[model samples]
Target: MNHTLAWRLVSGVKINHLCTPRIAIPSKAVTGSQQVREFSTSYKRSTVMPAWVIDKYGSNEVLRLNNNTEFPIIHYPNEVIVKINATSLNPIDVNMRNGYGSASLNMSRDPLNVKTTGCEFPLVLGRDLSGVVMECGLNVRYFKPGDQVWGAVPPWKQGTLAEFVVASGNEISMKPKSLSHTEAASLPYVTLTAWAALVNSCRLNKQKCPGKRILIIGASGGVGTAAIQLLKAWGGHVTAVCSEDAFSLIKDIGADEVIDYKAEKLEEQLKSKQPFDVILDNVGGTTEKLALQFLKPWSGATYVTLVTPFLYNNDRLGIADGMMRTGVTLSSKVVKHLCKGVHYRWGFFSPSGQSLDEIGLLVENGQIRPVIDEIFPFSEVPKAFSKVEKGHARGKTVIRVTESSK
Candidate 1:
């Protein structure tokens, strides 16, 4: 396995509060027809907009703020154009900036290989955004012009590090009225990732979560923090593993127990919390091997890890051979762990507006909150990338993309 790739993928995959007034959307009295009429008359479509883009992937130095990046358009009737207000950085953003996951992402960008090589140049890198609907495609029904929204853009699409972005209607939902654009921007990517791992892969939800014990490895980062609040809201017993310095933050977010991964007897510490119903591994490498040992045997216990070699394998080998290798490796691990009476599964970031809709309810009800570590101006995107690249982040690194986001 490529250790660097594995670590970077896991670390990069992994929030805050703001006092600014909520940006409200138009009332329901302004129906979709009215919204359409208003948009058609007032919205002057632009051919280009300011954006932070990369002509080539390498490091922070490669990022260029271009004032003439082509404006994104709605190709499908289900798509809508959003004027971005705020955005946030994930580990994936940092890794993508450094050329990680290029092979698979490039394939996704042009599945038929119709586009020439290097066509993905001048690409955008942000994954999460909180913005307002500027224009909607004809078939869009649930949202309209002036609606506020938040969602995670899939890695294959152009990202949110721009003045405006285009996303599918199914990829976004109503933003929480309680949080500012900056705070709302911090949750989507990481929260959706955590939701996929726990609720999708592990099959834990509010109904299934109560009385269940869940363990989160690398529990102070973006995904870890989100996972803690989610589990707690569902009444699960959450044990968070992170550096000792992050213990307070972990506890403040409702972690039932906190274990310092750097403790002298790390394995012993984990053993004491044995028989966990689900183990969410955010830090890959040796932690992947060590974590499975704590799951309960033969009780539908599962070990779901977000750090898989799927993208790495594809990047190193071509898609065909890489997928075959990844399948064989995952099958072997699953079978081996099944023999030990536990199930092993690889968790991935799944884009789900439905999940965000439910999570938005949670936020409005005060069951979940954004955990932001730092915020940078749009001009300092490179600096934000550098901060995430250094790691040890308490929560998330955010970017205020528009002045009005303040």
Candidate 2:
């Protein structure tokens, strides 16, 4: 008699399989009735895998590393499994882990309304990856086994923390030939976000780009650094803002003027050089107000932010009441922008093959360079997130998922 395999996924969860050796019995000694009883109550084995999971979300301490979790397998026809070589972190991952956006995340994970979304245990977390395809589904058209690719996985899907992850064919593109696995890993999510914000949202592409005055706040971080290169590539005049420690770096990369954000009376200094046609803000809180002081008026000035509570509401006061509060706060900001005649837009990271393809081309052609701070092995994922949370990283912090990737 053969053992039956049972699948336990309602929406999308990891289900794994492993083999066990069967014990042989003496054929003459065992009778027909004995065989029936033994087959009905045979010993079953548990197959396990390695993964990082958090039961209830809170701080880093809440995360648990387990070696007995189920492995990731192909769940959809359009998906392909990648043998992940490297992965990187984003602020959105931190937000999701801390329950800041539980309500909406729940809706995305549990689209069928099973009420088991936020409650799903052992949830894997990671977004960007650089790796080789291991298997392809029947409907996958763009890639096959052994092809090196990179892309950002959607938040609702199972993430890239494991050794292998499944992503849609449209979510990835070939990795840049000029970058290493670690260097390639650092670019996708941040690169995609930067390209989308400057090109797609703010219309900073080549046609509208030449000679426009642009201000970039938090210019030492990943998104800010990428934005500086894109703006310079499009021929925009760039002014970068950062602490005194980062001024030299921002300038070497191509900032026409670098301002120390920590300097006393910073607003007055920006006001001194007023009328910026565009503002790309990575630092939130008071950013919208500060940028308006320098934004060009009645001349197509635009303000875009990547960090905002635009989707995640402060839901401590019950979902309905919290939504009402969020509505009032959001409306107030929009009205302020309307009064100022400056276009305010909030940008979010979307999995885009077209954007990734464009960015890969830039890297290949030496148009943009990746600024990486540190490379930690997979064993140090918790430490990586902690480094990012300090809000002072000079560049991106990346994770080398495989031991031999270095």
Candidate 3:
């Protein structure tokens, strides 16, 4: 295992490093009788939990299964504790493991720094989770114990790779009864990203979707797959761009038209179609700008990228006077011309319960299908991640964390 150091800022989390001998789980970080009860339960339980933990940051080889105490049951009034049944590996997880992506690197290096500097080492990785609610915080009213739930959580407080994780109750939604935990786990990050990009960031109105044309780059990715279906649901005509190998898969996922990005020139192929009303660009690089050339003038377009702005030269200036002046001027101009009346939304998907509810409804109704590529046993997280890092994964890759009966 190639262990390397990284840093992260954990809100209220003081440990620079967590080691064995089970550090006395803080009794009560907050004062209150309810708080004491909430925290006491975590230590009261005697079951040792299994987790794929990373002693240091690196690749899949660094992931090691360890028996650790159950996560502290302590919850803020707004928090919820989940007994994770299944979890999905996003590109963010892999990027975090390799200590590569801007988000991952920043999160690890500055656990207390919210400004995204770099990520920390020994970060247990996993983003989207589908599980059962084992405990609810004192102030949590949205959820109750025994509720089947699924959703994303703040990347910093990662215990999902283990038997339990604590998250804001508002970040969870009732898991759709129609799908299994594994299937639901696969949807959170992708669906949340799609929801934020298309609905929140892109401002895609359902009423405006009828007969409108939209282009989705990297249409076979997790977010791309979700985008194609959501756009189609809104009654928009979707033009999907993907490698030749994934062409049929994209088409099956409801893309009205498919572009073989490898075979033909993107702009040239899209020229005949003229300006599209909106474009969702998952792949940055020249592909993003080239797709912009096909956007219709004054037609209300938006370009959304999962990749961070700094990586894509988004020109974000810090609070400093010098950076403010220069960054603001350039950023405004770039957004203006990116598309004719087009909005540029550089997005980082937030965990939300409401969004997950919407996605669950869509899946329960069969408006969207869970595209599962592979399922790995709990011990095979490394193999699952290796497949994801290769970038050839067909759809979502799932890891079974625990059996339901347990």
Highest-TM-score candidate: 1
lDDT of 1 at 363: 99
Q: Of 2 and 3, which scores higher on lDDT?
A: 2
Model 3 clash tally? 26
lDDT of 3 by residue, 76-103 (tens): 6677778899988888787666644434
lDDT of 1 by residue, 209-297 (tens): 99999999999999999999999999999998899999999999999999987776668897766579999999989988888888999
Q: TM-scores, in order shown? A: 0.89, 0.84, 0.81
Give the 10-residue window scoring lowest on summed lDDT in candidate 3. 1-10
* Superposed model 2: Cα runs more than 4 Å off: 1-48, 317-332
**Residue ranges of candidate 1 with Cα displaced over 4 Å:** 1-45
**Model 2, global lDDT:** 0.76
The Cα RMSD in angstroms, rounded to one decimal, for candidate 2 relative to the true structure is 8.0
Candidate 3 structure, TM-score to reference? 0.81
> Which model scores highest in lDDT?
1
Error of 2 at 380 (Å): 1.5
